[model samples]
Target chain A: MLGDIKTVAQGTFDRYFKMKELYVILILCILNIAALSRYDVLTLNMGKEFMIDGALAILTVVALITSMAVIFEKSRELREKTAHFIITKPYGRSSYIWGKFIGISFLAIFNMAILTAGALIVFKLTSYENVMANNLATEFIYAALLITAEAIVLTALGLFFSMFLSDTITALMVLVFFILGHSFYILEKMSSESSKIFGWVSDILPNLHNLDLKSAITDNITITQDVLGYGLLYAVLYAVAFVAASSMIFSRKDIS
Target chain B: MYAIETHNLYKTFGWFLSKRKVHALNNLELKVPENVIYGFLGPNGAGKTTTIKILLGLVIPSKGHSKIFGIDTHDPDTRNHVGFLPENPKFYPYLTASDFLDFCGKIIHMDAMERSKRKDELLEKVGLTHAANQKMEGFSRGMLQRMGIAQALISDPDLIILDEPITGLDPMGRADIKRILLELREEGKTIFFSSHILSDVERMCDMVGIINHGQLIEHGSLDELRSDIGVNIHTTGVASNALMEGEKLCDYITLKNGEAIFTLTNKSDKDTVMKFISDNGGSVIRSVKLQEELEAFFLRRIQNDEKAREEEVN
Candidate 1:
């Protein structure tokens, strides 16, 4: 397991290094988000302006991009026929599924990490009294935890779609899932306001809105322990189901 | 005992609407004796690849069974002992030949020393030592194929399955692969491969199976195939009326004017017939057995079937 993890980590880091487009967009957004602090409009209440509004947008975009990373990976692997090399060994199916998930998941985290780091650097540079005085440690940890859950669910969803779909369909469907996955909160809200059928639909829908905890980080709002625990549990359960499902589907697949 | 066996193997693809179920292997039966270079011959859509795929466990047999080394193919152990190379071999383009082999070694879970020793040995055998470190992305078709062979042989498997191993090779490349296959055979490995090059099969194979239209029309040793070319002889310098209408020679020999032609189906019977003709009052003329080229023999069989279908329709 350690060897597998190491191999996956190396492969992921190597891939992240090469995916210039990803790094470029992510860095640009981090800088863009940091620069938004220049506007007093966003600084009125750090909670409402920076964390709630600004961080919500970042989490949504990151979730969407990370989900699509599944397609990026599947296209490269399927098109190049790398599966033949990977599929013929011990733990081949699981290694391929999880290795890819972690690879892209780590990349997604790195993107978010850069933003958080950038936010800290801006605080250091600007030395805003509240930004400097307020302890970012707790809120940063909360933000990290929320992003991790979001990354897990998105990665699972991505892997599920990638397992059976061809390169093109995998990419397209992941895009669809990303858009739909991130908007699950709205879907659920809309469904609840509609009919009983909608209620049932919302019940099945994963509440991604719960994953958005940027307000707590930016505005220094305290996150309830139960709420955090529920979101964590939901992400874990969803990830486990999807990964298990992908394993079953891929196990029977003919690599030739 | 045979190293590989298949009974009534049938596979169909596609379903419903466009339902173009290619009965890729229609009740195809095969038995490959252990420790021989078994050349599987076929044209396009002849189900050669399909049979190989089924044997390699890359496919599900719709209604039949196959075994390798006396073990059922669906058994995981069977795959562990068998090595395969698909037609149009595809590998990770980013990986060099050595890295690819290393990856494959890791996949099959070979111990470090064993994988390295085997990798070096296979690279040398395939003559890819100079290019081992070069990325496969720019390798020629023949190079890719050679690396593919090397990859398959990494585990030093009991049975090696190659689909069209030498199809798109220059003379030298073909010779190299044939040499390697021969060497592997010398090492007591069972090599089963398909090829359109009938001559290659004729030269390399101890046993050959020809599949066409999802059916195994013929299979046996090359000598058996040559014999099955079936008794056609044309000759000149024969005395007139050498063949009597009701004679055993009549059944075996065809007379063309003054010339007596007899295909030697059985060598011993050829002498007996000649003696009978001489004793029966007709002079024996020149007689020789003819050998049909494998290609000609294949074309004739396929053509005859077409003719039979046409006549049936009429």
Candidate 2:
């Protein structure tokens, strides 16, 4: 089973790589690197706040693009029935769910890692004296990690909807899930104004606001290890639950 | 052990509330022995694809069960010894032939060295060695079909199931596939395939099953099915009057150029017809006994089923 997952992961990665989507993401990374490095060179005295925001924007765009690419490829596979060649092999549906989730997650992490490293290099080379004074180094890394976790959860949701839904519906559904997950706190507040029971119901939706750490980093709020660990745990739980549901639905779906 | 065994298998599609139920397979009891090419004969909408899908674990059967090499079809491990080519399968267009086969080999847990070796060998066998590096998006229909075969054989599986493998190929393409299938059979692989071309099945199938309207109407060796239709006698150099009338035991008789051609429901009619020819001042230059062809047998069975259904409705 492990071998099957690895095979599917590699296959998915290669397919995406061939589609030139990865190249686009790479180009985006390069642009971010050049822009950040130029900013650092022009204003050596500029504070670390600008650097942290640059890292956040680059990673967030990378995450969104990776999710969209993964979802689009999966939809095409279903539409063309190309997935039959893979699913009918000597592997169960769980392998597919894990493989796709991990495959897309790996792409997301790899992209974020490259851009984050580039951002760090620019910061260290230009703003070495201010890096630790403003805590920009650690905060930049934390922001990248946070976005990667969010991307993992989003990848799982995209795969879940792609299993049985059409391309348009799957895209629309995933987009809605992402928007609601991030802004669920607003619903919670509105519900609390009406009744306590309603507020609890609203909380049933995954509160992705917890995963957003950009504000926390930019505001220089102290993000302890416990806070990061809790955020990671929440993302992992949601990803696991979504992937499990995808496997169950995909296993029973009629490929015809 | 049988290569494939399905006992009282059944499948139905659609829901129950204002639902349209399609009985894809109805009590289909099939047993195909090892190391033989079995032709699954049927027309469109005859449940041929459904049965293959059920056995491949693509669609769950509504009733009963099926097994491959004594292992249940529902189990993923059962596919370890099996290879399948879905009807007109569409592969990942982004993958080249080499990459596609490599992916298939990896899914089967083949070692890297062995996977590379088999990939080269299968691409050559399918006449796609030159196109191994070309992506499938530029492939023609025939090329895709050949690649499908190559992928199915990547694992060198024991049991191979193909649906309509040679439907729309040109003569040369059809012949190439036929040759490949024959070679596979020679290597002692069990092949179960469905085809609209009766001649191909008649030439290659060791055993056959005729299905219609979700039911297995006939199943046995070609000879066994042929024997049920008795014998056909074609005679020449005989007077047409000999087949004209009186004690004519032939069911269907056609005469041309003073020769007689007809079918004998029983062997006893052969001697009687010859004697009549001799008494009519004629002679039998040639007499051959031939059995009914697969096409005829298939049509007869399907027609009977349709007639029965009509009778019940009326």
Candidate 3:
């Protein structure tokens, strides 16, 4: 049984080693860098932003997108009528679902790492924003720690959604929730001056904006320790909660 | 112990709106012995696929029980020795031929090197080595079906379950598939396949089960069932009026167009029946018994079933 699970895990990860999906991540990174280059704000302190800001945040978003893509596309055979080939294999159904989840997550992490290097290259080529380069580098490096935490939460949520829904609906629903998650930052700010109910709603929604430090990269800002710690705690809590829920749903759900 | 057995295997689905229960396999009882190709024959919607699904543990049997090699089908370990090719097999369109087999090997827990070696061997056996590097998206129907067979054998399973393994193949492709199935049978694999192609089944199967309306109408060795439903003895060239008069009033005789024909109650009685016609004013111009072809036998069974239904309706 241990061997069975390991083989499944290894095969699942090996699927992501495909060159086609890897190209998608590379294309996304080049596009991201090109978009960032268009902003003069990013040009102002490119090196400082690298030394002091979060590079992995962009990757976290991209990784989430890819994770959701693999969930819908790569692992869809489980629900199809012709999946009997895989379903008939030894202990197949659970292995496929979990294997696909792990494989997609591994690919996402690798994509994040690649994009981080892309960000680094941009910082190195531009000399105008050389101030606080060391700080920016430290900030970006720290971003890895935080964004990975964010990724766990995102992947867990994606897996949770995959449990009860078809691939298309799950992907669409995740995309919608992603938009909603980003808008919650505006709601969080409004909670300070507006109605108490509005503040309560903001509190209820996952504050995914904390995972994004793009403004800091462009404007040479640093997140406070208190905010970082709170965001880290929220990320951890959300990851644990969602992963637990995902496993429970996955255990009960019939992919076959 | 039986090589494969099913005790009242049934699969049911509940339609949400109408709340109707669809029993795909209704109390299906099956037994397949070792080292024999079992042909599962049925018209569309006869639950042939459903029974195969239960055998491979792809679907949960809603009622009754299914076992493979004496192990419960629901048990994961039971599938370790089994392989399957589903109807209209869907493969990963993006993976190259070798890569797909490697993937199958991995699921069966073969190490990478062994997986690679086995992949090549199975590919060669299925006649897919030349197209080994080609992605399946560009493969023709025959190619896809061949690839499906290769993947099914990647693990070198002891039991190979194929559902309509030859639905869309050219004569050569069909011959190739038939050869592979025969080879597997020679290697002592229990080759259980469902096919509408009775010729393939007739030429390949050692034993066969004919199913209709979610029921097993007949199950036995081909020779056994053939002799049971046996062929219609076509007696030809009898003198018209003499043959008619001779056949008439003979309670078991049937006449058609200048020939007297009837099924023998036993093989030993064929000569006796022919002798009767010759003795009674009619000369047995050409005496012969029907050489049972599986297709014709099955069609006759189907027509008989239809007529029975019509009579009941009237």
1 against 3, candidate with superior DockQ:
3
- Per-residue lDDT of candidate 1, residues B20-57 (tens digit): 66678888989998899999887788888778867866
User: Order of candidates by lDDT, top first?
Assistant: 2, 1, 3
True contacts kept of each: 0.22, 0.69, 0.53
Predicted complex 1: DockQ:
0.24
- Candidate 1: where is the Cα deviation over 4 Å? A1-31, A34-63, A88-95, A106-119, A126-129, A132-141, A163-166, A186-203, A215-220, A224-226, A254-256, B16-18, B227-290, B305-314
Judged by lDDT against the true structure, how good is candidate 1?
A: 0.71
- In candidate 3, stretches whose alpha carbon ends up further than 4 angstroms from where it belongs are A1-17, A20-25, A31-35, A41-61, A79-84, A128-134, A148-152, A182-256, B15-18, B93-96, B129-139, B227-292, B299-314
DockQ scores of the candidates: 0.24, 0.56, 0.42
The chain A TM-scores for the candidates, taken one by one, are 0.77, 0.83, 0.71
Report lDDT per candidate: 0.71, 0.80, 0.70
What's the TM-score of each model vs. the native?
0.77, 0.82, 0.76
Give one clash count per candidate, in the order shown: 2, 0, 7
Relative to the unseen true structure, what is the C-alpha lDDT of residue B149 in candidate 3, on a scale of 0 to 100? Answer: 86
Best by DockQ: 2
lDDT of 3 by residue, B72-184 (tens): 88787888788888877677777899988887786677888999899889888988889999998899878888888888888778898898989888888888889999999
Ranking by TM-score: 2, 1, 3
Best by lDDT: 2
**How many backbone collisions does model 2 have?**
0
Q: On a 0 to 1 DockQ scale, where is model 3? A: 0.42
